[model samples]
Target: MSFTQRLRRRLFPPRDAIEGYENEELVDTICRKTAAYQGQANWPLVADLTTVLDFGGGAGVHYKTARQQSPDIRWAVVETPAMVRRAMELATDRLRFFERIEEAADWLGNVDLIHSNGAIQYVPNPVRTIRSLCAVAPAKLIWHRVPISEGEGRREVQTSYLSDNGPGQAPSLAEKLVRYERTWIPEQAFIRAHEGYRMAERSPDPREHGTYQFRFVPD
Candidate 1:
């Protein structure tokens, strides 16, 4: 770990967002997510099973521990290279890992559910990234523990998140962690890019520190 990572580990020990979720709260979250997905119209109507793509799912720990209701259900996790390495070590027969959302090119159109939680704030180009996911036209997209404060204000506004996405050493954590990431919030362009997906739910995070949690899906 670098100095910044060392300092972060001291202040906030190595942790995943889902790892911070309590068992009961996590259960409730899963229930809501399932309800939302199943309640959708014509969801996986022709498919015999559901496939999931989780953005920023760490090490596949949550999926590994959680019992799947159906043996037919499958999931793939996309994360940073570091997390991808960790996730690969824990990947199961149904679990896969990708360094980027686009890296899972083969999964396009095959995925039925797209999931993200507390991960939008860390994307350097959320607009473009979301557009990529939207292109796949998944049946449902679920978001949780996402920040919503947009627009410039008294405080300095941060646009890009720092990461090792480029060909260089990783950037400091604060450079990326310190921002609101309002672009994730629905707008005309985002809505158009996301295949007419609209905001279905916006509420305070039941299990984490976020201004709001959002759920978007096409009607």
Candidate 2:
């Protein structure tokens, strides 16, 4: 290994650095973004919505605009254990956090919508996770920033700096890196995984290449 690689291993260590989501600074950044949501569109199908399950919603950032649009909306966020621990502090009567999809689904009783933005690809098994979310039987499902491949699926490592996690200006800091694994699954396989849902809408995400947004409803 190179000298810089050796130094990073010695100082930060892979075991400690691998799961960057657990970092306290990243959590703080996420909470800060929640505050700076800036009226971003929460969900397009916002009308008549009561309860929602936000899969992979770190710090429940979407709740800011959602609450503004639907004052009584009950929102549950399913995140990593580390995120869940730190995110619970932001929870309220209408907003909560969970480490598992099932728990969040149960908490809402009847999830009117399940929304996952830029999250599904991070899981180890996207198909299995998709199936589990399908079991929740939500009235509608929306996935954004989903990386799709036309050929065989593959895994890749994603490196993100602290500033990448933001909806607002971020504090300048020294080179701090967070690394995680993500998968690019075949598009057809991804669609088939949604067993009981039919694709209602499909749109390309202009911000990220090879990523798309998919909306599904009862098949």
Candidate 3:
């Protein structure tokens, strides 16, 4: 058996597929983000009609539970073609997946929510990525789990084995081949130029990744 099969068998005896394991992996994110949006008046969620674009959303397991909590919401996760294929298979009336963020351009100024959790760092050019997101002009943006350097804002391309979710039972089981990723500490100028939004909140991620979460809202 593969290492993943062995680990899953040993770690999650009752879980039959990798998808089931992914749901468990994203449970905390679903719970915490759901709670944050539930009490808020703007993006990420709306008690009434809502639409969310989850950039670099993988498999979209995080949205699975969220769909139950906010049935009135429309969610689209933009990911790689392979991930999009799998997530698309699980799509429902309230949830869908896309291969490109630009597909939701029609939602400009009305998307309600845009979220990118642990995503920007992997983007080739985060500035360009955020610009595209800003163009969509959602009411609120959830920028979470972003690793940043303390000194200056610079882009980096590093090779490392990355995992989909948090490290599971045996971290080695989920390590992908060596891959290069670009990350930035994020300069303030980009958000400043966006015009309609303001950085309303900033907080250190509770985790140890030295990342910060920023929330942008209508100015």
Candidate 4:
């Protein structure tokens, strides 16, 4: 990992109880809303006897909700190590957890649906990742990502490089905020990246957030 990535992981550890609580609530709301929408859309194609791959699924909140909504479907939750542990603790036998994408990819050939919400944006090469998923799974892909927009802010915090001796001088705020930029995938760029896939639906989030959902069938 790069210096910044290492620092980010340490400072803002992936397992933040407060943030996880809030995120779980938000994800639950989104899942319920999306499930209702999909139900009304008459997309009964995969309603029964389908396998779901919840890629980058944190805490498996969506996986639980989806399983309840579609009891017949098999579910797999793929997330980071910390998150996989948490999900495994909460998940049922119908839902399995994988700590790595490669492990999830191994089962992709058997999946009938791939779902990723607010996760692909973190990927360094989302196009390649999506293509890999598509290669293994020949089925519907439902993905949501934060679209590139203005007025986004990124900030970093720094503390003294502590030692056992005593206290050290703290880093300046200017030194702390090393990198700040809006990180979002443009809609056109995303569409172009998955051009071979047939887009079934495109909808902006009702909350007026920069997030968007694209439901498509892999070619």
Candidate 5:
């Protein structure tokens, strides 16, 4: 919170590159959310499954509700190495974290569901990641808040305030700004990337502009 740093942030904003997403405040918030998560509309989907591969599932917060409903559910989260280190604090017998998709799949034995929320865009290569996820051959793949394009895919920078991730925090000028590069995958290209999977559901995400949710199943 130095004067120079504050001034630089005002001028440059959140466009600064993020490395491993290691923000301490954000980590605290994720841990708190993981501890207190009640549920979401997708709770039933999670509750019905016994094993899941969560891509970009920060600290595996979504497991809270699923664990409540299906006590034996094994949830494996695939995240960055830095995040894996921080998220290990919340790991338990049924919950685990890995830095690679293959490792997660190996640990889970059989993945009933693959889930990702607002995460694909942040990856360096969405197509490569999608291919990796497909290699797991999960029964179902769900993506929420995926940025889609009607034409050729492209990269863009997303800037947001830390409070955006908070349920109770108020916005402030001093709130830390975050910027990350995202790829807007072409609609058709994205759909075709899953070699043997068919797009079971595709719909616009009500909360995010130009983004959609998708569900894929074996063809």
Candidate 6:
């Protein structure tokens, strides 16, 4: 496995602390906002969408919010085993869960949409993966990823909490956002790899952190 994949497996171990906090209302709100933005940008395409594949779907939170926004939409959450189990527990008829992307691929001949949030950064072959997914689903692809930029270090510090102090005992939030100073791919590289896709929009996070939203469509 690649370093990125290994890091994800370790940091986001099946049912870790982060998983426990995923169902919070704030998380739900953010997901809803993201889905709304995607819908607006790809409104014409999504209007006819009935089934969607939520790739790297974490605990089915996004799926839940998406269902509320589009009741006629059916969804399948594709994630790692740990997340898959959590999703199954939260599953409804319109929302199902799968552990592998290939499993979901079998059910979708040409899906209307693909929702991928905060997951592709760990993919070793992002270009190939994107192409494969796009080939299987020609409608629309909404991918959100963290951008690597200059001035930040690539190492992230993580803290482990030990037992029983009061609420005050909780450790300060570890700086998990590592800056990949030299790793930012140039726009040309993105254009080259993502051949048939046109850059519809590029929105950078206002916090000065390197996260960005690049909306694209197949040419």
In order, the Cα lDDT scores of the candidates are: 0.54, 0.84, 0.61, 0.55, 0.82, 0.54
Q: Cα miss at 151, model 6 (Å)?
A: 12
Q: lDDT per residue, candidate 1, 1-219, as tens digits?
A: 489966875686433322221233332333233223322223332245457788866555334333244445577788766555543555666777887676563654477767777666556666677778876677778777765545421222443223312222342332322223333444344344566687787678877553466667776
> Model 5 off-target regions past 4 Å?
1-20, 23-25, 36-42, 166-174
Model 5 whole-model lDDT (C-alpha atoms): 0.82
In the predicted model 3, the residue pairs found to clash are none
User: By TM-score, who's the top model here?
Assistant: 2
lDDT of 2 at 82: 78
Against the hidden true structure, what lDDT does model 6 obtain?
A: 0.54
Which tens-of-lDDT digit does each residue in 102-175 have in candidate 2?
A: 99998899989999999999988999999999999999999999999989899998976565685666655444
Q: In what order do the candidates fall by lDDT, top score first? A: 2, 5, 3, 4, 1, 6
**TM-score per candidate, chains pooled:** 0.58, 0.86, 0.67, 0.59, 0.84, 0.59
TM-score ranking of the models:
2, 5, 3, 4, 6, 1
Candidate 5 local lDDT, 72-166, one digit each (tens) = 99999998787788789889999999999999999999999999999988888898889889999999999999999889999977777664553
Record all residue pairs in model 6 with backbone atoms less than 3 Å apart, i.e. clashing. 196-219
For each of the candidates, the C-alpha root-mean-square deviation to the true structure, in angstroms, is 11.9, 5.9, 8.6, 12.8, 5.2, 10.8
Report the lDDT tens digits of candidate 3 across residue range 12-62. 544222332124334333323332332322333445546888887665645
lDDT: which candidate is best? 2
The better-scoring model by TM-score among 2 and 5 is: 2
- State which candidate, 2 or 3, has the greater lDDT: 2
